[model samples]
Target: MSEGLEESHQLFGRVAEEYDAARPRYPEALYVALEEQSGMRLAGARVVDVGAGTGISTRGLLDRGARVAAVDRSDRMLSRLRARTACGALLADGNDLPFRDGAADLVTYAQSWHWLDPALSVAEAVRVTGPEGAVAAWWNTVDAGKADWLAAYQVRLAESCSGYVGPALPGWSMPPIAGVMAAAGLAVRETWIGWTRSVRLDDFLTDLRSRSYVARLNGHEVEELVNRERAEIGRVFADGRLTVPMRVYLATGRKSRPGGG
Candidate 1:
């Protein structure tokens, strides 16, 4: 769709298992914002979940009773969603959605929109969503302050690890997001809340290695970089587990009403 997505998808494929294990789900407060402002009801409504990686966000929406068509370029990610209890999987991209105009009540992209070009994706999202529909995108950022040790570990991961920098910190580094949704003729709003998860060092490092930036590295170099991260993890989290702090940023926008766009 945009940027080095094929490579990113391949990288995700390589560590789908670890990605599933380490990635945290969206916070409930963010979901509450979606339910209130997204213009689509969560229960029993049809939703198209773009880049439904590991079914993480899909599961949340499903729990709200939304019937989700989980779509992603990564077969491994889609496979993960397929194995889940609820989800209809589709292999697709955000720039060229397969669904027809006005097909879905909600169109959502979670934690994967930056891998795509925003202008093109917003247009495509508007094209496929119903006039009354809404577009929602969210990213989970490592909060890095729930505990002292975890914050130090994140610094090591971002500074010393080869693959984890961009993926781990895109939430921190992306350009202005407030008006990105406005391009698609949708009004935008955003909110943030913190979350935490307990994860093993190896699983976390594998997930880091699954990033496109990491996969771009030579094998030995990638291993070496992650090894440094692992050593830091050991120094910081000698107990074999760490409570990872995360911040969920929820962005919601609604499709232009009939004849409005």
Candidate 2:
């Protein structure tokens, strides 16, 4: 891994607690999207979650009855994962995966795709997913509405993460997922899902701190950012709770058959 990406991964490790508190899990709608696109049920599939930080994604698979093996480079994050979910957690890097060829029926990278060395990760994913299985990737970006305050918060989020990166790296500025899947010998396909979540202003602020961008801040900057966000929240909500919106995108593809690209 390159220095920047490696650095970003380490940053996430240091902030695992904040991460667990702040990051939002994929809505059940996400599972439906993957299930629909892959045409594979999770009950008996061997699912591999690459960059499975804190097992937020891994748990999603576990809930669906997947036999999950979650791989992450950070032991700190994986430890939290172990305590929270029954899925198998491996301390490993995405670039050099450990599973055997055709070992998995479904391989997923949920919200963590940006932290990977795409070219190598794609090759690794291809090698692990069985010939007729699927590779599904997902991410959650801030919703623009349902709360006047959250839209304002998005501005701050953009500032915090704007050139910021995590230990594995800055994740992808523009994720080359479909292309990577293609290069890895998969035919590309995708689905989109959108929804809103209700959260307190404090919870929303906690969510921001979970991002690598804000997580990398120094004491003063971090305080200032949180205070600024709180001020905005104060203006918008009297009871301290607010409804925030979200958009989720899921992309999936079948592993290339041996004789085809």
Candidate 3:
């Protein structure tokens, strides 16, 4: 990966607490879809969640009775994960996971794959996953161009931040995953699940701070942007809260089984 991309992954550590407090959680429907795709029930699956910052995704797997190992490169982020959950937290890179070959029934990357080189990360995933086991990656994006206020706020951010494409916002498309999985010798499947979350205005603002683009801002710029954004949000949402419509795009594929299909 480029230095800037690597730096963006590390940037979350600076606001680890806020990230844990504000980043959206994965909907249970998405997890169910993943389980279906992998043909592995969550209740007994041995899962490794790579780039599992702050235990958000790890906790979800654990909640469904999976035994999960949460892996991340940032000690600060891992510390937050450990504080919130009992899952094993491994400080490691996605490209170089510390797992025995074929040790995991399923390996996952949630909202973190952009930090990795897909070639290396997918290879590592394939190595750690048992025959017929799966690798899944997903991101929580806006469901549609439904939140105009949020759209305007993102525009403000784009205007302020250099070369910011706002991938976290609505309308930013992911590259084709079929070719990516094919290169790893896996058959890919894709799914989408829609969900909604409502948050207080302050929490909504803090969530923006967790983005690499926004986190790149200087303090003065952030404060000014927050003030402007808060007003825009207020104009659209009454009662000091906002409802966010979100869609999770899940791409999953299984490792080739021995004596393959």
Candidate 4:
């Protein structure tokens, strides 16, 4: 891994608890869409959830009846995952999985794919899953266009946060996921799911702080940023409540079965 990426991973390890408590869960519809696009049911499927930080996605997969192995490089993150879910939590890296060939019926990355090297991780995902098995990845991004306050928030983040790269807001650039999956000999499909959440301003700020970029800042810097954000948001929401819009970008790729279409 690159030095910067390694630093980011270490930062996430330090804030695992904050991340688990504040991050928003994926919409139920995203899982439904995953099954539809992948042509595979989660019920009873053997799944390897790569980059399974804090088991947020693992719990969801488990709820859908998937037998999931939650894998991450950070023991701190995996510790949180193990504490909350009964799934097998493994200390592993996505770029180099420790599973045997065809060991999984499906492999998934939720909100964590961006941290990995797709060229290596995509191939590893394909190698571990059986023929016709699927690999799915998704990210929940803020729909800044849906609200004026959110748009201003993005602008503020862009100006003040050194680690921020604008991923939380709409129109941010993403890696070429479809291209990488196709190169790995899998058929790829993509979809977007839009949703909204009503959260207390304090809780929303907590969620914002959990963002990898924001979490990496020093304590005083983070506090200053949060205070400024609170004030700006308060101006828009005097009641200290916010209706945050979200968009889930999902991509599912299925390996072709031998002697089948």
Residues forming the 10-long window of minimal summed lDDT in candidate 3: 163-172
How does candidate 3 score on lDDT?
0.83
Error of 3 at 24 (Å): 0.9
lDDT tens readout by residue for model 2, 1-261 = 353544757888888888888678889989987887777888889999998988899998999889999999888999989987987789988888898999999889888776788788887887888878888888886555445555556655666655443222333233669878876667777766788777877877777676677776777887888898788777878788876677787888786443454
Scored against the true structure, residue 237 in model 4 reaches a CA lDDT of 91
Q: All candidates' TM-scores?
A: 0.85, 0.89, 0.93, 0.94
| Candidate 4 error regions (>4 Å) | 1-6, 167-171, 257-259
* Model 2 spans > 4 angstroms off: 1-6, 145-148, 160-174, 256-261
Ordered from best to worst lDDT, the candidate numbers read 4, 3, 2, 1
The sequence of per-residue lDDT tens digits that candidate 4 reaches over residues 29-90 is 99999999888899999999999999899999999999999999888888989887998888
Clashing pairs in 1: 143-245
Deviation from truth (RMSD, Å), model 4: 2.0
Kindly give the stretch of ten consecutive residues in candidate 1 with the minimal lDDT sum.
161-170
Q: Report RMSD (Å) for each prediction in the order shown.
A: 3.4, 3.8, 2.4, 2.0
Winner on lDDT between 2 and 4 is: 4
Of 2 and 3, the candidate ranking higher by TM-score = 3
Q: Tens digit of lDDT per residue, candidate 3, span 1-261? A: 464654745788888988999998999899899887766789989999999999889999999999999999989999999997997899999999999999998999998887788788988998999886888888887654667666666677778876465544456676455568878888788888989988898998898877777777788988888898888788788788878888899998877543476
Q: Which sequence of candidate numbers ranks them by TM-score, best first?
A: 4, 3, 2, 1
The lDDT for every candidate, in the order shown, is: 0.76, 0.78, 0.83, 0.87
Instruction: Give me the displacement of residue 232 in model 1, in angstroms.
Output: 1.4
Native-vs-model 1 lDDT?
A: 0.76
